[model samples]
Target: LAKTTQPISMDSYEGQEVNITCSHNNIATNDYITWYQQFPSQGPRFIIQGYKTKVTNEVASLFIPADRKSSTLSLPRVSLSDTAVYYCLVGVLSGGAQKLVFGQGTRLTINP
Candidate 1:
């Protein structure tokens, strides 16, 4: 299994673009980077996924460098409601991508 490391916490304000980076130096070539956002007492919601380069969706964008040793999750113009814990997961699609192992995540706090 691949392990990920990210900042313990972050702070932002309304209408701010927040970027969270995660390091996975041991990630395998077949592994993919997945970002999830979880609100209090709720299940994590998938934000985006990427193997290399960039991937964008309605909520966020995932950027993976060519080396694939790290990835950055970009949240564009976030609001106070965007406050939540973000997780960077590394897993292989064939190995059940949805079955991500639990780990410490980055807590994002949005203020007015």
Candidate 2:
């Protein structure tokens, strides 16, 4: 399994952009890195996924280095409501009796 590490917390002001980087020094060949965003009481929503290079969506952008050891999540014009926990995960999706495990994520506080 590929283990990831990220900041425990970050502070950002409203209407500004925020970027959180995660490191996975031992990423495996079968593992694909994915990012998730979670609000107060809701389950995390998928932000982006990339095996290599960059991938962007309407909510955020993900940039992965060539070695696939690290990735970054970028949020544009973040608002107070965007204050939440961001998680970077590296694993393979499984069927049958498999379940996904989450890590201690980066808490982003958007101050107004």
Candidate 3:
């Protein structure tokens, strides 16, 4: 199950909420949905993770449906500094280890 899809880029004004959606139509039952945010020249930072329904963190909120086929990462009141590449990933436990496959990330640009 490697099929994942996301928008290439998005533009938003500061102080607005930003939501990035990812599609994983072939997602497995045991897989978990995770999101990561990366700034220029910096490693990706974990945002949130969820298996179903909704999970909220200080930085973002993750929403996964009961079908588990897709997820959305929502950033509240984003600022210019929040501009970054957001990655959606599916992780599964395999052979006593965690395996994650990532898809093309969405580049979010927060404007003034």
Highest lDDT against the true fold, candidate: 3
lDDT per residue as tens, model 1, 1-112 = 5556899999999999999999877676676788888999999998898999999988998899999988999999999999999999885233544344433689999999
Give the per-residue lDDT of model 3 (tens digit) for 89-111. Answer: 98644566656768699999999
In candidate 3, residue 20 scores what lDDT?
A: 96
Taking all chains together, each candidate's TM-score versus the true structure is: 0.87, 0.84, 0.89
Where model 1 places Cα greater than 4 Å from the true spot, the runs are 92-103
Go through the candidates in order and give the C-alpha RMSD of each one to the true structure.
Answer: 3.4, 3.7, 2.7
Which sections of candidate 2 miss by over 4 Å?
92-101
Worst 10 residues of 1 by lDDT: 92-101
TM-score of 3: 0.89
**What is candidate 2's local distance difference test score?**
0.81
Ranking by TM-score: 3, 1, 2
Better of 2 and 3 by lDDT: 3
Which of 1 and 2 is ahead in lDDT? Answer: 1
Report how far off residue 30 is in candidate 2 (Å). Answer: 3.4
